[model samples]
Target: MKTWKVLWRVMMVLCVCVFTVNIVSYPQPEVTEVLSKYGSRSEEVRQIQTKLKQWGYYFGSVDGIYGTQTQDAVIKFQKKNGLRVDGIAGPETLAAIGISSSSGSSGSTGASTSDVNLLARTISAEARGEPYSGQVAVGAVILNRVEHPSFPDTIAGVIYQPGAFSCLNDGQFDQPVAESAYRAARDALNGVDPSGGAIYYYNPVTATNEWIRSRPIINTIGQHVFCM
Candidate 1:
């Protein structure tokens, strides 16, 4: 009887050890990092809404609230871009939308990183096939419009102004941005007026507006004629 008891105690100890080992070796579930999702409200959410609205993805107001509407919009954007359709604005989604997760303030030009990204996207959309100098010139024309009294004073305002850019309506603005366009945007913001101080530019071969053609020509770069 004493031997049996001792053997039983030993078996219990062995069972306990096996259980502890299993507990220690078991795989843990991955912890996902969520940047924005439903019930989240912040400046980042507002920026996301603004960008989606600009791209014609979200029709709701930019109230900074990540509700069902916001989630639906994010899902749509993800679907269009071939991203994971989780309806959560994770790092990848934020980066794809041209927004930085960092809270860094605007640059010396009083333009935030998003502004540079928007300008770069515009240059990419409008002058993707143009020469490097022409790309910079396109960015310069947009910046000039921002400074001109007749146009909006803000970059977003000027870019989104009704009928300002044809690319915005022709679906070209939604395409991927070119790498050169980023450099052109930065140069244009730095006051590199490759368009020769001209506030307007258009491709003569494709330009349909007689008024734009009638504008006094200032410089010619690549296929675009810069005008005032």
Candidate 2:
């Protein structure tokens, strides 16, 4: 009987140890990992930081690192926008923050057909052979300039303003718009400004305009330098 009791106690201890080991081996999953998380670093995260700061949800620097502060800001934005509040910049969260994943109805400009066609043609002419983001950035610069006090308040006015775009004076702006240019125009209208609110962009290699070179640069994309 003494031997049996001792053996039973040992078996119980072994069972408890095995159970603890299993518990530790498999932990719970995180909230979500679609867009970004704590410790993530990328350009997308940097853009997210900038947008959140612009909208007053974040006060941290616009660094590409996604740390505790970025996560906190994301949570606040999600809460304010009635998202899942998982503290992750997923597709829904990003769209609500003025960044859309696909071409949807998030931040549409609601302009007429004439305006879109003109912008599309301008984008195709100015940003031809550039990356898709660069194309969108070009379109965004026009939109940004339209809102700036220093530039014309209308799309046509900005595009037609003397000495604003080389393509306009070089007859390139009259070229037929490409399919990609149309998509880029729609994206820009939907508030997808990859230039981060830049009002101008110029190619450093081919541009001879010294006056444009003197503007404060905001960011670079493909072969263009976006400026404020």
Candidate 3:
């Protein structure tokens, strides 16, 4: 009996250590993320986190911050070759990011005439060939901007605002839609609002526009900083 107790204790200790490693390696998500992921907070959010943990995609306390672990896991997957990581997701992320949650709708609708395609066209106009989740995020930022009263009321107007997106200024927005922009656009329109409600976004890492520094930041994601 004593040997069995010792064995049991050893197993418990090992389990604890493994759990600790996972928690430490991954940051927890913020509370709002939890609410958004499940489309409404309830016992189901906990269940989603539990599943995320099981899949090595969530590391935060099950208390539901949707914290760093979730973000890092999301970032890690996005960083991998050929993966799009917007942190928040739709079908693409659901299928590829190794995490899944219902967005309160029946997911996206009509693959042929879907918002995803509309989003794709919009993204093509704005970001064109920009790579990966950053481009997707940029598209989301523009949409977020459109939602704000301070910006234009439509995607075309905001993007076409003089010197807003250089691509638009240089006539790229009028060009044929590219595949990457389509993916990013689709992801954004699918309810993956990664910018939350940011009204402006810029790449400080590459930007030479001095005026962008004046805007107050609402959040940062990938390589872009979003502001009000």
Candidate 4:
């Protein structure tokens, strides 16, 4: 009976270890966070791809590129939303289409409204005119500012400070935001960063600050140039 008891205890310990591993391996929402920050695949890209698949926008695979089928779907969404029918995902187009991002974010993290809104403003100013991948990168810029020693430690401070963003200075950021902008912000709030740890971005042709110009260039998309 002593030998039997030892075998049972060993089996219980093994079972406990297996259960712990399963818990660790379970696919958490945080998986999206990992993909958001480091991954090049964008949330908007995923959203458009999913929407196109659902709404019969495209019969092809949901690749993240804004090619023909995706463009057609965007036009369809724009037509549905009473926007100018441009087969492109511009700010107006993104604004017109209602996005249904899983509110799985704030509910999961209990994030405050201000945090969410601040992120949304940044998204609106930076990536509203750009593509979905660019939106995530803009959100990453705010998060990077929080961690950087030279800038303010919060999103509101970084955004609201004088001369930080043209939109913030001219009250453009205060305008009604697109649903895509809101979703992008929520994605950022939920820890999706796309800037690849970029600390600064500027329009290269007009950049005057010598210090700003000295940083290594990372990527250029739309009108902004991102840097470390």
Candidate 5:
């Protein structure tokens, strides 16, 4: 009886050791970072909606609710910005939209450094020989297209839209950007509308497209004509 009791106690101890080992070796589930996904309701969502609306990505009412409309807008923004099209406002997406995820507030309303550079490059390519205001007018037309319902809702989108800009195909876009183009881009981003809210512009002397020539002219800057 004594031996049996001792053996039973030893087995119990071994069983307890095995159980502890199992507990220690078992894989824990990965902790997923919480993100503003569909159905989430908060001020962050409202900010996201506001930014999207301002950038012409979202058309829904800013009600702070993450519904289908918000998700679809997020997807559209993501696709336009070359982000993962998950439709969830994750940290990356929030940062891309110029919003702080931790504070739930917006960052600077100005264009990012990359945006400025792109706009400058485009201005340099399209209007390097024109006056300073003319270069800014070109940038303004690009920004106007971003806000227009008929064009893509982002600068890069509008600039790179197939057959949108002739410079993209004529090798001028790849040339060194002019120094004044940078200032012009910044001025245009800062709400300077030398284009007079025009969504289109072209050099009448070089433009051969009849469709573009038919656009109602808004203003003339240097060699280019700004149009609606």
Candidate 6:
């Protein structure tokens, strides 16, 4: 009887292990279409912002960069339109937004190219060697500041604000932007707030500002501690 009980317990343990593995291995929904966020600077994203703004959804500038305000607008639109509330401009979401793939909406470069370049430069300067998500986190912080009362209202204004970022003061912002930086900027603009809506971030090892450190921490990504 003891031997039988031992075998049954082992079987139960094995079953639990298998179940856990299956849960962990479950596939998540793949984001196959354009994922616009807070710092994304593309024509397609601009169109979404413009349409959403016209329809009383978005209220921010239509500068082709996705930001927190744009994300909120997209979510409201998606929720109201009975579409998936993921806030991503996937095929179905775009179609519902009155933008056909064949229409090639928001594709024109126009003058928004400068905004993209500027954001890419900022990301590259601040998070050159960080992980891709970390770079996005850096961009998200910039966008968060734009929406915050204490910070500037625009991307350029936030980035160029006096004594805002050390990279700008140290001439790191002048370096050529990296391709990864552009991707990271787009990710952040696409509403990927990996820092959980953080408005500030700093490396714990290098951060000397006691005030910044005193703020409530949100999360740590790469080498930076994101703060609310």
What is the per-residue lDDT of model 1 for residues 39-154, given as tens digits with 9 covering 90 to 100? 99999999999988877778999999999989999999787554689999886567557566553335676566667877898999999899999999999999998789998676
Which candidate do you rate higher for lDDT, 2 or 6? 2
| Of 3 and 6, the candidate ranking higher by lDDT | 6
Worst 10 residues of 3 by lDDT: 97-106
Candidate 4 lDDT over residue span 150-182, tens digit each: 886656556644567776555566566777887
The alpha-carbon deviation from the true structure for residue 65 of candidate 4, after best TM-score superposition, in angstroms, is: 55
Evaluated at residue 122, the lDDT of candidate 5 is 89
Q: Kindly report which residue pairs in candidate 4 clash with one another.
A: none
Off by over 4 Å in 1: 1-103
- Under the 3 Å rule for N, CA and C atoms, how many clashes does model 5 have? 0
Which ten residues in a row are the worst by lDDT in model 4? 31-40
Reference-based lDDT, each prediction: 0.84, 0.80, 0.58, 0.65, 0.84, 0.76
Candidate 6, run of 10 with poorest lDDT: 103-112
TM-score pick, better of 2 and 4: 2
Which digits, one per residue and each the tens of the lDDT, describe model 2 over residues 1-228?
Answer: 999999999999999999999999988887844567788899889988987786566899999999999999999866643458888887656655545454223234656444566678889999999999999999999999888999856675676566677786687866666899989998998899999999988999998889989999999999999997
Q: Point out the higher-scoring one by lDDT: 1 or 6.
A: 1
What would the TM-scores of all predictions be? Answer: 0.59, 0.52, 0.42, 0.49, 0.55, 0.52
Off by over 4 Å in 4: 1-105
The model with the greatest TM-score is 1
User: Which has the higher TM-score value, candidate number 5 or candidate number 6?
Assistant: 5
Task: Name the lDDT value of residue 166 in candidate 2.
Answer: 77
Which stretches in model 2 have alpha-carbon errors above 4 Å?
1-108
* Candidate 3 or 2, higher TM-score: 2
What does candidate 6 score on TM? 0.52
Candidate 5 C-alpha error for residue 224, in Å: 0.5
* Residue pairs in candidate 1 whose N, alpha carbon or C atoms collide under 3 angstroms: none
